[model samples]
Target: MTRSVALLAVLAVALLTALSSIFIVDERQKALVLQFGRVVDVKEDPGLAFKLPLIQEVVYYDDRILSRDLDPIEVTPLDDRRLVVDAFARYRIADVNQFRQATGAAGDQSIAVAGRRLDSILRSQTREILGSVSSNDILSSDRAALMLRIRNGAIRDAEALGLEVIDVRLKRTDLPRENLDATFARMRAEREREATDERARGQEAAQRIRAQADRTVVELTSDARRDAEIIRGEADANRNAIFAEAYGADAEFFQFYRSLAAYRASLLEGNSTMVISPDSEFFNYLKSDLGTQ
Candidate 1:
């Protein structure tokens, strides 16, 4: 019985030692072997990894890329325009040993510390670089170039933290709430001024066109009146010439025709009245005999 118990105890001890000596590293993870609070080995491959039981411990970190969204920070540009900028970054632990040394911690704590450091770097760099340029540049097509500069600057600064900053992006940029109202008011005023100027110019052009049209109309009316008067004068002169020619051709016949015309004019209206003697020159044709007079 004593010999059997001793063998079973040995088997139990072996099982515990074997279990404690092995660790797993997944395809997406990396492992660090720390002995007595000091990093001794780094396991970057997948599958089972070995370490001394009860003396060395394993710490795993994700090898995949990680993302962090930073808080919005306010910055002022060279034009003295205030803007709130929200940014984010994509990073990964490139060197596990360096990362561990840099953070002086392991696991989640190290990641958190590194993230905070990167956040600080990004905020400071964003402020400095963006603040140096004018607000118009920030709002213009040059924004892409400015963001690239910020990203590059951040990548350089983030290297010390063992972080590979793959990409840095600006998520949002806007004017502060305090300035929005004032900005809108100023813009409205500018538009109003422009509209007023446009209206003034339009009215001036309209007036000039109207004056030209009026002048043209007056000239047309004057020409029409002058032509009508000239035509009337010519017609009158032709009638007078016909009358003189008829009188010269036959004096008696002309006098008779003129007296007949006068009688028709005076008697055409039923209410018309004329006072004259029957023997007067106006009625001589009516009083005399036509064949012998």
Candidate 2:
């Protein structure tokens, strides 16, 4: 019975040993086998992997793309205007061996270490590239091109840390809180100044148009008066000519007509008295048979 118990204990120890020596590498992970705290073998392929029990251990690193959010950074543009920028980056560990060596951290802590190191690299590049351009370029659709430049600048530095920088993006760019009021005030003042200039131009045009209209009215009035005076003088001259022609054509008839017109003038609605010599020529027309036709 004691022999059977001893054999059972021996089987349990072997089973535990076998379980400890074998490890599974997931599809999403790459494992590094270390003996006595030194890297000995790498197990990148998924499936079962083996290492000496109680002598070697395995450390796994993610074999997939990762992301990190960088802290907000301030940059002064070419115009000396400062802007606050929020950004993030996407990266992948291309060389686990180099990554482990560069980070000098074991287990999951190395991932954190990589992220912190990448932050510094990206921040420096972001400041350098963004500062070289104007604020308008950073705020406009050209921002995409600026982000590409920043990513390119960081790529070289990231490679030294065994990281491949896939892309970097500027999430938000804004004026500093203190500058907002000043910017808005300046914009408002500019709009008002433009409005004033436009109104002045409109007024000047209106005045010019009014002056032209006034001049037209004065010219037209003077021209009409001169034409009326000419017409009146011509009518008077034509009537005088007709009278002179009639006098020349018949002296006796014209004299008789003139006497009759004077008679009509002397006689009025009331009784009229007129003393004249009987031999006077005024009586000639009355004396005759009512005057010639």
Candidate 3:
């Protein structure tokens, strides 16, 4: 009975040792087998891996790419203008051994520790590259080039920490809250001033056109009136010449016509007040029908 109990204890101990020696690694994980606090082997493959029963241990780490969203950081440009920039980074652990050494992950991989360090590197590069140019450059479409520069600059430092920086992107860039109101007001005023100047120029052009038209009208009227007066004077001179020719042609008939006109004037309808001699020359035409023509 004592031998039977001893045999059962030996079998149990062997089973426990075999169970502890075997470990399964998943497809998404890369593992490091450590012996007495030091790495003895690296198992980047999936499936069962064997290690010494009570002397070795297995540590797992994620082998996929990772991303971190960084907080907004303030930077000043060469133009002495302050701007706020928000950014994000993509990275991957390319060398697990170097990563473990750099991060001191001998026992376990702390994502927080790696992330904080990466965040610092990204912020530093962002500030350095962005500060080299003016604020206008940061706000313009040249931003893609600027972001590429920041990513390139960060690659070197991140590699020291066993991280490969895939890309660095600027999420948003903007002016501070204290400057928005002043900038907007200045822009509004400039637009209004331009509008006012345009209106004034238009009004001045219209006035000039109106004045020219008025002057042309006045000149036309003056010319027409002068021409009419000249025509009237010519007509009066022609009439006087015709009358002088007629008077010189026959003095007797002209005098006879004048005497008849004078008689008609003296003998009126409501006023006949001529007191003259009966043998006067004024009555020659009426005194005898055809006096002595």
Query: What tens digits encode model 2's per-residue C-alpha lDDT throughout 1-293?
Result: 99999999999999999999999999998888999889999888899999999999999999888999999999999999999999999998888888889999976799999999999999999999999999999999767889999899898999888889999999999998888788999999999999999999999999999999999999999999999989988988898787789899987788888888898898876989989888787778888885743
TM-score of each: 0.85, 0.69, 0.69
* Clash list (residue pairs), candidate 1: none
Kindly list the per-residue Cα lDDT of model 1 for residues 171-274, writing each as its tens digit: 88889987988889999999999999999999999999999999999999999999999999999999999999999999988878878888898898668878
Q: Which candidate number has the best lDDT?
A: 2
Worst window of 10 by summed lDDT in candidate 2: 284-293
Cα RMSD of all models vs. native, in order, equals 2.9, 6.5, 7.0
Positional deviation of residue 258's Cα in model 2 after best superposition, in angstroms: 20
Clashes of 2: 0
Better of 2 and 3 by lDDT: 2
Q: Give the deviation of candidate 1 from the true structure as CA RMSD.
A: 2.9
Which residue ranges in model 2 land beyond 4 Å of their true spot? 143-145, 219-293
